[model samples]
Target chain A: MTTLSVRNLRTHFFTKEGVAKAVDGVDFDVAPGEILGLVGESGSGKTVTGFSILGLIDPPGRIVEGSSIRFNGEELTAARPERLRAIRGSEIAMIFQDPMMTLNPVLRVDTQMIETVQAHLKVSEADARDRARKALVQVGIPSPDERLRAYPHQFSGGMRQRVAIAIALLHKPKLIVADEPTTALDVTIQGQILFEVQRLCRESGTAMIWVTHDLAVVAGLADRIAVMYAGRIVETGRTADVIERPMHPYTKGLIGSVPSQNTRGHKLAQIPGMTPSLLRLPRGCAFKARCPIAIDQCNEMPALEEHRPGHWARCWRATG
Target chain B: MIVYIIRRLMQAALVMVVMSVLVFAGIYLIGDPVLMMISPDASELEREAVRKALHLDLPMWQQYLLFVNDALHGNFGKSFLAGQPAMGLIFERFPATLELAFASLVLSLAIGLPLGVYAGLRPHTAGSKTIMTGSILGFSLPNFWVGLMLIMVFAVLLPDLVPGWPRLPASGRGATVDVLGVKLSFLTGDGLLHLLLPAVTLSLYKGALIVRLARATAREVLPMDYVKFARAKGLSERRIVGVHVLKNIMIPIATVSGLEFGQTVAFAVVTETIFSWPGVGKLLIDSILLLDRPVVVAYLVIIVFFFVALNLVVDLLYSVLDPRVRLESRAT
Candidate 1:
């Protein structure tokens, strides 16, 4: 069974100026034990998609009508708040970008973890602590016993992220929406965390949506990749196909701009334009102004089409 | 911690010495107590005798030296008018003022914290708007005017309007029960009733201060990533607000509350006078009018002591609320 299936999801922010469609008609799915990398630049709504899955959108922003988010065949967009909260951190979990910001500074690690356990399960304090200790060990944290008594600030940057990962893995959730969990970390630490996360997901058979802007990061870790632009997924396919045989012009430009893709001592390829503001999008294709292969016919909005097996692109020229 | 406290105590001793010097020199400039004490019909010889007896004839430096020596020996001289030891007089009234200050502090925390949290959490709600507006009124109104208005409403007007309402006495501690050799008015029902009006009047401004502080801090902390993380952990709304939001906001609240408590204790003068409460603040004002040097000096010195002690308590509380502070201090 699919761990998550999102179809026609439109999350909009109703500001005084205009309705900003942050996530516009997005569709994707993750099978059990699969890793889907939701790759996008800033303002592309990758994080918003993650938050919507958890029903964490606050006032002035909402998952509009006609959107569907099904986790294990259960519709989440229409679920009650209590039901959504129950599913969160137990059936589904989330990990944020900044580890330093995620854990409560005033609370000790054990206090935070124990309460997290008690929030869903009716377990004794000692039992909860025992589980927390085990979770910490599973994430490869040294001195798990003493570390539980320390505050968030006491740990180094890498260690803090390990704690956050441990907390997310405590409930053995079936799905995790990690939003750039290692972006703020150093390169070595990022690799270590990626390795740990991949190992844990494989061991637990947990499906995960890894949201990031780094193509290089997902190239190695993600089984499939979904490249997003202007709040919509422009192209998606298996990681090897998306990287080596990119169909959409936007995805080609993204893969070309990576520093490792070009010959040594050569000027790196660059995408020409900034992301369009979501409040007032252009009339037809959002990437028309920036697309190098634009023609007179590019004025019309293109629909996502499968040009190859299990590979989709949102461009008219993909078939040609 | 012990070293820190010992250092703080040494600094406190220095501050008290400097404060005593300033108070001594300042009081000397205000006019001779001998001039204000004796009758107008008294002869020059009587004035000279009074000056010598009170040591007013000595140089200011010499007088201060004598005062310091007596203070070192736990004798802060005697009140010129009352002919009683100044420390004894102040100590007798200290409990009443402290009780009033503490009562108002408790009242403020009990009322202000919840309202502030509510206002911060749902800042756009109508009830929060009303609470914020009331806090603004609490801040802007003068203490004496608020005290008078409260007296007029609860003590004077309400009793006249409602036949069954008891006529609240406008002044004095009604009756006191001695607990551990300190007279407390809150023990008996009538005494508590007598305390109610003055306590409310005293608490309003401080309560408003705490509300603004707590609201601002809570608003700042509510948007922190830790708070959102708490929600993502499947925590109930109440647990998120109570544990995460409250704990983070308490740092600033504790600091402001401690300083404000010290201020109320030192300067509840207008409230004490309006209600005719025989507390240290009233005694201070009376001593100033009578130019009772020893009593005024003793009062100010004690206030300084309270401030230093309260600051220490606040720092200690900071360690408890924030572990970073605790660990760093331990490291040092």
Candidate 2:
């Protein structure tokens, strides 16, 4: 079953400079127990997409009127604040990139985790704390009882992320929007967290959308991958297909930018030029200005087209 | 934690010692207290007798030693005007000053926190802009002038239109029973009325300070990732701000309040003089005019001690507000 289906999602910011389309038209889905990696660079709006899924966007930046977010067949486009609050952290939860952000620094881990549980549940404080402890143990944190008494700063970065993951799993929500939960950790910690998270999804049948800029992490972890650029998905398919046969040039540039053992002592292939300011993106395909295979029709906005059964690309020049 | 407090107390003592020396020397540099204390037509013999009694005949260092020796025993000599121990006089008035300082603090926190939170929650809105502008005016105008203006409006002019509150005494420690024939004591209905204007005038600037500080800190905290995370947790706007944003901004608030409290206690001279309130600040100004060196020096020393104590309070407050600080202190 589809857990989340965001269609024509458009979030923009009205700043003094101009309207920056942070998350323009976008569409994607996550099925039960399947992990969809929303891979993009810093400004491609992957984080905004995650925030928009939870209705967490603030003022000056808004999810425009026409956007529709359907989760488990319930319309969330014009969902009231009360409805969204009821759904969030119970039916759907989000784990931020920074675990410190997930936990209040001044509060005890147990207090924070228990409160997170009680925010959506009517359980007693002791019962909530027990669930928090269990969740920590599930996330591979040992000495759950002692660790629960500590603050966020007491835990290392890796451990803190695990605590955050534990908080996300407190209710075993149907969907979790994890925005680069392991991006801040070292590689070994990253690998460990990735394995635990992937296993958690598999065992619990919880659908997840892991947003990250690290292609390597997504390549190894995600069942499916979506490559976003300039506030739109440029290419998406099975993780192996997207990695092996990148159809869009921006995807190719991203894959090439990765430092490989195969290219020892050689210069890395970098995507030339900076990302266009979201406020002043060109009046055409946003990536067309940098596309090596650009054509006259590339000046027009390209619809996301299904080039194969499950693979998709939004470039006019993409072909089998 | 005990060691930390002990260290702080020792540091406070050292600071007081250094400040006493400075204040003692500094007041003497201003003028001779004997000249101000004695009449111009006083006989030379009487002047000499007064000088000898005050130990002015001795050198400055010896006199400082004598002053310290006497001060250690809580004997700040005598207020030449009051003909009483200066330390005793200060103690008598400390409660009145404490009342004003604490009341102003309570008023500022009560008013400033909400005003600032509102200004921060909705920046650039019409109401927020008005508050910001009003706060700026509060900050710019001197308290003495504001006090006088308040007196003119409420005490001098408002009586013509209104009957009850119009008779509010503009400048006095205690109120008279003539207004509406209701007897009001220093600790009762009239007492609070007497406190209202002076406290408001005194608190206005610091209250404005608290407002701006709260607004700036709250504004900075609103965009924090943790705050955003709280919102995403399905917490209501009120809960997120009250639980997450308020606590995060509390360190700055505590620091500002502590400093402002110390300042109010030490520097309420202008407001007290304008309103003729019976506070230590009024006593200090009077002592300065009379060149009562002991009283002035003793007041300065007490203020220094207050600042040190306030510093300690602020540190403790920081630890309370942020567990991170407490953990660090424990580690040390």
Candidate 3:
């Protein structure tokens, strides 16, 4: 069953110059326990899409009216602040790229984790601390009771991210949005955290949307992948299928640019040209200017359509 | 923590020693008190007698030694004006300035913090805009001008403009009231009435200062990744700001307020003089003008001591408020 559904999401920023369509007409669905990797380059609106899901966009930037984000059949986009607060953190959690950013520098680990538990639940402090300890243990911390006494800076980068993951899992949230939670860690630590997170999601049956620009991380961990460009999803499908048979030219270019995919002593293939500024996106397909297989019909924007069963791409040339 | 305090105390003692010498030498070199104190018609014999009595005839180093030795023995010498002990006279007027400074500080914080938070939350709103504009006047308007402006509107004109409007006093510390059988000045209604003008004047510029500090700090804090993380955690707006942002902004606010508190007392000279308020500030100015060296030196030493105490308190508060500082300091 679908755990979260976002339809026609449009988040724009009203700037001094003009409106910047940061995330324009985005749509996706996540089933129970499913991990959907929302992959994109910088400024592709992937992070905006994540923030829009949580109704966390501040003004000057706003989720334009008519964007529908439904979680467990509740209309979250239009939910009252009280109701939104009820669902947030308790049912839906977000893991940030920097763990220190997630943890308040002035507070102890236990205080924050305990507060997260009590924010929605009517649990006593002891019960909250118990659950916090359990969450910490679940995230692979040793002696969480002692660790909880330490501050955020007391923990190493890897340990800090673990504590952050623990906080996200404190309530066994229905949907967890991780925005590159381990991008700053070394490769080995990143691998460890990714594995632990994947295991937790699998065991808990919690749906997740992992927002990242690193396709390599998503390739090993995600159940499905959605490729975004200029603020819209250009392609999406089962992870293995999309990796092996990328129908969208942009997806093909991304997969080709991976260093390991190239032979030794040979230059790695790179997508040509810079990512077009979202403020001045092309009239047609945003990638048309850089598209190797562009045709006259490409002058018209192509809607995201199913090229095969359960396989989608937003391109006129996406024929199986 | 004990070690830190001990170190601080030792440093403060050294600073006090250096400050005393500088103030003593600086004051003596600038002007001669005998010239101001003695009548112009006095004989050379009388002048020599006066100089000998005050030890002005002694060598500079001998004078310093005498000053330090007498100071250590709790004798700061007589006030050249009233012939009362300098310390005793200064202490008598101290509570008035302290009461004024504390009242204004409280008034500014109570008003500034909330207004600043509101401005930060809705930065583009008309109210915040007006506040921003008003605060500029707060920053740029001289304290004396504000005092005069407030007096013109509230003291001089308001009573005539509105019936039953009690005319606020233009100057003086007002009549004392009996509190618990003691004649307390600030506890009285008339005293508060007189305090209104000076307190409001002092609070206005400081309140503006706090507003700008809070507004800037709030703006910087709101965009931090932790704030986004907090929002995502589904914390209420109040909790996000109160629990997270306010504490962070407090670091800078506390530091600035500490400095300002010391400044309010130090610079209260002009405000006190304008109003004829019998505070240490007014006393300092009178002493300086009269070349009352002992009174002036004692007043400065008291101010320097207050400053060091305030700085230490602010540093300790930083550790309490920010765990990062605590850990870093401990590590060092």
Candidate 4:
């Protein structure tokens, strides 16, 4: 069953210069126990889309129109603050890139995690503490009980991120949104976190949205992948198909830019030119200026269409 | 932690010593003590007695030694004007000023913190804009003007406009009230009623400072990846502000609070003059006008001490607020 469906999401920021279409009309779904990777470069609106789904955008930046977010058939787009509060932490959890941001500097790890559990569930402090300890253990934290008493500052960067992950897993939410949760950690720790997250999701039947810019990380972990550019998804499909048989020119360029794909000592293939400003986006296809396969008709915006079974691309030439 | 405390105390001592030297030098630079005592019309015997009384006959180093020795033994000598022990005078006045300073600090925190959090959470909303504009006005207005305005509105205008409008006392301690068979005087017990106007006047400047600090700190903390993660975890906005934002914002708030506390003490001079409140500010002004050298020196020392002590407390709070700070210090 579909655990979360975000249809035609649009988010924008109002500034003195003009409106910045950060997330302009995007769609995706996460099924039970499935891992969906939303991949994009910086300012591609990937983060904004994640934030919009969570209703986390501050003023000046707002969810404009055409957003219908549903979880288990419950409409979230219009969920009241109280209802959303009830659903958050209990049914949906998110892990962030920086662990310090998750952990309060003045509060002990145990105090924070226990409070997080007690906020949603009515249980004794001891019981909440037990759950927090168990969560720390599950996330591969060493000396769980002792570590719980330690502050975020006592832990290393990697350990702090693990603690953050532990806090997110404490409630066993049905859906988790991890936005670059391990991007700031070392490779070994990142692998460990990814392993734990994947195992937990599969065992608990928890749907996850893993937003990242690292294709390799998604290649190993995500069941499906969506490639975003200039506030829209250019291509999406099963991870294997998207990586092996990329149809969109932007997707091809992204694949080409990977350093591991190049021969030893050879100059790495890089997508040239900066991402166009969302405030003054190109009149035609946002990627036309950088697309190697650009043609006369490429000047027109192309709809995201199915190129093959479960494989979608937003290029008229690709469809032909 | 102990080592850090010891280091800080040593630094504080160094500062105090430097301050004493500067204070003594400032008094000395004003004029020749011998010439002041031996005016043209003064008799030789009277001049000699005055010189002996001030220890002007001793060397500068010996005089400073005598001053420090007397200071250490809690004897600041007699005030040149009042002819009473300076230390005794300062102690008698300390409680009143301390009470006012604390009351004002509490008032500022209570009003400024919540307003700042709200403004930060919704930067461009009508409510936030209104608060921001009001705070800016509060910050720009002089404390004396605010004091006058408050007194006019509460003490003058309201009493005339309404029959039996409570008349605020011009000076002296507040009235005593009987509650639950207990005689409680605000001036002696709670101090809240007597503290109202002065606290408000003092808090206006501090409140403005705190609001700006809180807003800036909260805004910086709110966008951190963890805050978004907390929201994703389903924490309410209130929880986020109280637990997450407030805790993170404390370092900046502590700094602003400490500085403002010292500022309010200094500002109490004007506040005391306006309200005629008998606190250290009034004592300092009286001593200055009367040329009470010992009283002036003693008050300056006490003010310096309060400033130093406030900074020490703020420093200690840093470790409590961010444990990583302790860890980093230990590591170093």
Candidate 5:
């Protein structure tokens, strides 16, 4: 059973120049107590997909009709705005990159946390403060009382991100869409946050979608990995299987580009060519030009097919 | 807080000392007030007596010394024309200007803030475009011309168009009531009617200024990650705007509004002239033309003090709105 099931989801931006399809016909299911790493290059649709699940897309960008997002068996796209709002902070939560920018600089930590609690729950101010203090403790923040009274600017970068995570955990949400929440942090802090988040998800049975461009992060953190390109997922599988035996050439290229001890003192291999502009994507497999083994069969876009159990890739020619 | 206030007062005193010297020197260069006060046909002996009586015959430095001595003793001499204490004269006209400035400030904020926030929130809408265009007119039009047009429209044209419509009085403080020994026109119906025109005329420019400032600042602050985070938390749109957006934008708005209030009080000469409102601005203009040294110096010194106090208030207001500023000040 899944906490969230997205099917044929298409989020497009209608600008004056053209309709840029940011997320095109994507499908994924996140089970309770699972972490799904949505991996991509900078221009890929991972962040947009995250936003789509939250129903947080703003104007000029919209989730096209017929796209279905079901959370806990309820259709999210068809829900009223108030209903969607009701599900946002309590049932589902989001953590953004740059925690320094995410917290209001003018407000105290307690005020921000208390307001978040009050936004969904009808608790008294004292109860909300207690919840805030508890959430801070859950995130391993020391001296929660004093920290709650301090403004966001008073905290260091890592501390601020911990506070943001605390805010997300305040209601023990069932799902969290973290858009590179630790990407701006130091490597050590990143490891600490990943551990805390992994433990929190397992303990609380909450599903998470961690959107980032870093493959190494997802390799260690996510149960499954989905690699995207040009608004489509090119490959998704169990993290070990995908990392060891990537079916899609694009995923293989992505894994090759990461520097490891084996590739020490050697120039790292990279996918040749820039990420294709979504406004003017090539009319076939978006990765055809950059694919090392692209063939005539790649002239037409390939549908995702399971080449092995629980491992899927979008490519015409794939053999184990 | 006590230390802050004490420091600010000390700075104000230094500024006042410098201002007094400049004003004293500046008035000396504006020609003698005795000439303006005395009859043109007066004999030479009579002119000498008048100049000595008003201290116009003394050397500029000696005259300034006497003025400072009396000023330290809570005296600024008397107006050459009215023969009343110059400070007393200014104080009498002070209420009218204070009330007018306050009314204008209230009107501008009431009208400007919402329209500006709407424009900022939806910059592409037709309504926002229209407001932006109207603000341009408010900014570009000369104050006197706008004041005259207001008179032509509301005072002159509206009454003619609709019979039995109460025509707003064109000039003077109308039908004042005594409040705590102060004559206040706004307390009475006729006085409020008379106040409407000048107040609106003065508010238009400030209102437009506020609109542009609010719109720009709001647009800048609206997209901040905190604002988006606020939305993500499921807080209602009203709370986001009220607490997050409004509180942040209020820093710049408070500063501009405070300085604007001081400016209106001191320099609303054109509006006062068009509406013939008996305010300090009108009195200052009349005093300048008559070259009444004591009144001119007294009015300017009071304005300087007013500005100093306003700046202090704005700084305090900034601390209230933003905790970062409060924390920094406390640390110091």
Candidate 6:
């Protein structure tokens, strides 16, 4: 069953210059226990899509139009802020890139975690503390008791991110949106966090949206991958299919740009030019200007069509 | 922590010394002591005797040393105008000013903080815009003008318009009132009722400042990755704003609040004049006008002491509000 489905999500930001079409139109679904990686570069609307789903976008930026963000049959798109809040932390948790943002600087780790638990569940403070401790231990924090008493600043960057992950896991929410949670951590710590996150989600049958720019990280973790560019998803498919046989030029560029894939003596392949600004996206295909294989037919916007089973691409030439 | 405290104390001492020097210099630069004491009607012998009695014959350094030594020994000399010891006069009036300043500070925080939080949480919304506009207006208007307007409306206009529109006391504290089986005077109790006009006048600008700071700080933290994370975790808007935004914004707000509180205490001079409240601000102004050098210096010392003390308290609070700060400071 589809645990979460987002259809035609559109988000825009109103500025003095003009309205920035951040997430023009995007569609994806996360099945139960599946990990969907929403991959994109900075300002690709990946983060904006994640925020829109959570109803966390601030003013000037807004969800202009969207429909059927059905999480277990409930229309979350139209849900009130209060309703969203109740569903948040309880059913759909998110892990941020910066742990300090998750962990209150002034508050003790234990205090914040316990309060977070109690905020959703009607359990005793002691019970909440116990769950928090257990969660901390699960995240590989040594001496959970001692560490809980420590402040966010007391912990190293990696440890703080772990604590943030622990807090998200405390409620065991059905869906977790991790927006490059471990990007700031060291590679080894990142591996550990990724491992823990994957294991936790699989064990709990929790659907996750792992938004990241790192294809390698998604390659190992995500069940499916969606490549976004200029406020729209250009391609999406099963992880293996997308990685092994990338049809979209942007996805191909991204995969080829990976440092590890390059030969020892050869220079790394990088995608040419910067991402198109959302404020002034080009006519037809947003990536047409940057596409190596662009043709005259690329003047018209290509719909995201499945060229093969479970392999979607938004290029007319690719579909042909 | 001890080292930090000691360093701060040393700085405080240096500030006090500078304050004393400025005070002494200001009084000394005003004029020669002999000319001020002598009159045309007085003979040379009498004028000389008067100068000797007043210790005008001593060198400038000796006089300053004598003043400092006397001050250290809790002697502020006699007030030239009042003919009473400056120490006793200040002590008698200290509580009134302290009470007023404390009341104004509390009022400002009580109104300003929540308003700021509200304004910050909904920045572009009508409520937030209204608060922002109001605060800007409040901040720009002079305290004395506000005080006069308030007095005009509450004390005069309202009374004339409506019968028995409780006439607010123009000078001194108001009458007593009973509450919850306690006979509490407005002046002696919390002074809340009597404090309304003066407190509002004093707190208007401060409250506006707090709201502006709170809104800016809260708005900044609201969009942080952690806030989005918390929301994704299914945390409510109230929790997001109250727990996360409020706590994070507090460090900055507290800083501004402390400085503003000190400023309000210093700025109370004009408000006290308009309200006729017997606070330290009024006392200082009166002393300065009367050219009571000892009293003026003493008032400066007191004000400086309060300012430094408030700053110290704020610095200590930073550790409590942000552990990262404490740990980083300790590590450094």
| Model 5 lDDT tens row, A1-320 | 89999999999999999999999999999999999999998879999999899888988999999999999999999999999888888889999989989998888899999999999999999999999999999999999999999999999999999999999999899999999999999999999999999999999999999999999999999999999999999999999999999999999899999999999999999999998889998878999998889999898999998999999999987765
Per-model i-RMS: 0.7, 1.4, 1.1, 1.8, 0.8, 1.9
DockQ of 6: 0.65
- CA lDDT, every model vs. true structure: 0.91, 0.86, 0.88, 0.82, 0.91, 0.82
Better-scoring candidate (lDDT), 1 or 6: 1
Tell me how far the alpha carbon of residue A277 in candidate 5 is from the true structure, in angstroms, after superposition. 0.6
Q: Tens digits of per-residue lDDT for model 4 on B10-94?
A: 7766777787777776766665545633567888788788878888667767877898899889788887656689978877766
Model 1, range B308-330, lDDT digits (tens) per residue? 99998999999999888852355
Residue range A33-137, candidate 4, lDDT tens digits: 999999999999998888787788876899886688899999888989888877887788777767656676777888779878978989999999999999988
**What is the CAPRI rating of model 1's predicted complex?**
high
What does candidate 6's lDDT look like per residue over A294-319, in tens digits? Answer: 99989999999989998999998785
- Restricted to chain B, the TM-score per model reads 0.97, 0.91, 0.94, 0.88, 0.96, 0.89
TM-score, one value per model: 0.98, 0.93, 0.95, 0.90, 0.97, 0.90
Clashes of each: 0, 0, 0, 4, 0, 6
**Model 4: residues with Cα > 4 Å off, grouped in runs:** A14-16, A265-267, B29-44, B53-56, B175-193, B327-332
Candidate 5 C-alpha lDDT tens digits along B59-89: 9999999999999998988998999999999
lDDT (Cα) of model 3: 0.88
Comparison by lDDT, 1 against 3, better one = 1
lDDT for B182 in candidate 3 is: 39
Best model number under DockQ: 1
**Candidate 1 residue pairs in backbone clash:** none
True contacts kept of 3: 0.73
TM-score of chain A of each: 0.98, 0.97, 0.98, 0.97, 0.99, 0.97
Q: What CAPRI class is candidate 5?
A: medium
Candidate 2 residue B232 Cα shift, in angstroms, is: 1.2
Write model 3 residue lDDT over B1-332, tens digit each, in one string: 87877777787778889988888888888877888898999999998998999999998889889989999998998987688999988888887898788788888999888888889878999999999999998879998898888788888788889888988897988987755543445688888888888888888888998999999989998899888877777777788899788988888889888988889988798788777778889888889889898898888878888888898888889888887775335522
